[model samples]
Target: MADKRDYYEILELGKNASEDEIKKAYRKLARQYHPDVNKAADAETKFKEVKEAYDVLSDSGKRATYDQYGHVDPNQGFGGGGAGDFSGGFGDIFDMFFGGGGGRRDPNAPQRGNDLQYTMTIEFKEAIFGKETEITIPRTESCDTCHGSGAKPGTKPETCSVCKGSGQQEVVQNTPFGRMVNRRACTNCSGSGRIIKDKCGTCHGAGKVKRQRKINVRIPAGVDEGAQIRLSGEGEAGQRGGPAGDLYIVIRVKSHEFFEREGDDIYCEVPLTFAQAALGDEIEIPTLTEKVKLKIPAGTQTGTYFRLKGKGVPRLRGYGQGDQHVKVTVVTPTNLTEDQKELLRQFAGVAGESTSEHHESIFEKMKRAFRGD
Candidate 1:
C-alpha cells in the first residue's frame, strides 16, 4: 500500500489554508495530473491520491477529524466511511466549491426568480401633473401547476447519482512542484445536487413560463425622463421556493408642443401686435393654468419679458411654484389698404418732430457733434 501522507502536505499547503486558497491549489494540481492528459504508468493512481487529499483538506469538518486522528477512515466518527461511500460532509463542501460534483442532487433548496424590466412612455403633461396608467410587459412567471417546483404536483426530485449527492467530482494532477488534487462541479447534477424524475408539464420543467402581464403604475408628478420605478416582487417567479425578483419600470416623457421646460420653470413666446407693443395693453397669455392677463407697459419694446407669478409647472420636490416667462415678440402689420396708407402718411407728417426721449437724446448728440463739442 502507498504511504498515507498528510493531506495538507500532499497539496503543499498549511493545515489552516483558507477555503479559497485550497480550491485554487486543487484546480492547479488537478489540471496537471488528469489521467486524460497524463499517460504515465502511475498517473491514474497519483490522480486518485491527489483527489483523496483534497477531498479531506477542502472540508473543515473532515480536516478537523483528520487533524485529531491523523487519518480519515470509515471507522472514524462521521467520516465518509471508507472510499466511495459518498456519505461524508466533504461532498457538500465539494459541491459548493466546484459548482456541483458530477453527482446526485438535493431537491429542497429555494431559488431566486429572474428579474424583469419594462419601458413606459408618458405624456409630458401627464408626467408633470401625475397620472395613473396601465402597462403590459412580457415576463416569466411561476407555474401554477407545479408552484415553481419544476416537478409534478405530487412528485419530488431525486439526488443525483453521478456526484453521489456531493455535487462535485475529484480529479488528480501533477505539477512541477509535485502531485496535487482538484475538485470540480459534477456534470451530471450541474451544481444543484438534485434532478427531477418527472418534470412539471405546465412550465415544461423550467419552473417559469413566458406570459404577458398587465400592471397598473401610478406615475408621480414632476417625474423626469429616464426615472426608474421599482415594483417589488413583481418579476419572474423564483425556482423551488426562492423569493421573486423586482420589476423595474423605466419612464420616458414625451416632449410638449408649445411650452419648453427648464427644471421647474416653463418658457414660451407670446406674439404682441404693434398696437399692444407701442400703446401698453393688458393681454391674455396662455399658461399651464388658465389664460392670465399680463400688463404690457407703455412704450414696451420687442423682446421684452413678462412674468406671471405661480403660473409655471409645480416644483418637483421643494415648496412653492415657478414663474411663467412670456417673451413678447412685436408683430408688424403686412397688408395695408389705400386708406390705411393715407392715414399712416398723415401720422408720419405729424410725428416729424422727435417726441421720444431716445430720439431727442440722439438729436442733441448730433447737434453737439456738428458743433465739435
Candidate 2:
C-alpha cells in the first residue's frame, strides 16, 4: 500500500484547530473539489483526501484513540488476544455531533437549493384591501422517479469501505509530546457511512431536477412597498430528502392619483372659492368612501384642515379606522368683466365704511397693528 499521509497535512489545518474550524475548512474544500464542478485530473482524489482529514479532526473520541496509538492499527487486538476494535461507541458520538446515519435518512439535513425571490406590483387600493394572486416560478424540484434518494429502484446503497461504515477514519501521529490521534469523516461517503452504487437515471444522482411550479399566495391588507412576505416550504425543493427552504414575495404598490396615505390616515387637497370662504356654506368634500357635506365657517382662512371622522383606510390589525384630513385652498376669481367691475365699484361704495361681524373682527386687528399697540 502507498505510504499513509498525515491528516493535518492533507487538510492543511493546524493540530489545535477547533471543530468549527475543521468543518469550515471541509466545506470550502469540498465545494472547490466536488466532482460535479471540478474536472481536474486529480480533483476527485484531492477531494477524498480533504474529506478524510476532516473526518478525523472533527471527532473527539476517535482523535483521542489515534493520539494514544501513533499509527498503531486500531483493528489490532488491545491487551487481550481478541481482534482489536476501536469502531465501537463511535456511532453515539457521530449521532450526537452529526445526527444519525440510519437507513432512513433525515428530512431536515442541510442541502443547497436555488434561492427564489418574486416581485409583484399591486394597485394602491388593492394593497390596502388585500388580494389573492397566483405566481409561476421556474426552479429545481425533487426528482419524482428516485423520490430524492438518488438511487435506482430495487438497489440499495453499500457501506463506504474507506471508513468501514464508521463514517470516519482514525489517524495516529508521533509528536514531541508523545503520540497524537485524530478522527475525520470519510471522504468517500461524505460522512453518510454509505454510498450509492447505482444512481437514478432521471436525476443523475442529484435527487433533484429543474422545472416550473405554480403557487398561489394571499396578500394581507395594509401592505406597503418593499414589504416582504415569506412563504414557508414554497421554495425550490432540497436534494437527498432535505427539507425545502422559503420563498419571499416583495411588494410594490402603485402611486395613487387622488389621495396620499400616511400610516392609516389619508390626505387630500380641496379648492374653495373666495365666496365659500367669505360666506359660511355647506360644501361637498370628497372622501375615500363618498362625498360628505362640510360646513365652512365664515372667515375661514386658506390652508385650513377639515377632518372627516372614520373616512380613511381601515386598520390592518386594530379595531378603529383612520380619519381623512382635507386641506382647503382659497381660489380668487381673476379677469373680471367690465360690467362686474362697475358693479363691484358701486357695491364698494356702499360697503366701504361698514364692517360685518366677521370682517369687523379682522379689521380691528389690522387697525391695532397700524397704531403700534
Best by TM-score: 1
Instruction: Give the 10-residue window scoring lowest on summed lDDT in candidate 1.
Output: 80-89
Q: Model 1: per-residue lDDT, tens digit, 1-373?
A: 1356767877789977899988888876765666656778987566556777787787788777788877645455433324333332333434544566645354446777777888888888887788888888888888888877678989977888887666667765554324444566778878666787899988877778889988888887777778888999989878777898999989888888888777777889888776687788998888886888788998886678788778777677887778888898766555878887566556655878544545543335534653658
Query: What does candidate 2's lDDT look like per residue over 1-373, in tens digits?
Result: 1365766667677777788887888877876776545789887567656755665567786666545763454654221213323332223333433545423233234575556799999998887778998999887788888887778877766778897676776666543223434465668888767788899999887678888789999998777778899998888887555668789999998988888888888898888776788787898988776789999999887778999888877787887778899998776556879986566556655767433434543335544653657
Clashes of 1: 24
The global C-alpha lDDT for each of the candidates, from Candidate 1 onward, is: 0.73, 0.71
**Residue 278, candidate 2: how far off, in angstroms?**
2.5
Candidate 2 residue runs with Cα over 4 Å from true position: 1-116, 164-186, 190-194, 239-242, 332-373
Q: TM-score of model 1 relative to the true fold? A: 0.63
lDDT of 1: 0.73
* Predicted structure 2: lDDT: 0.71
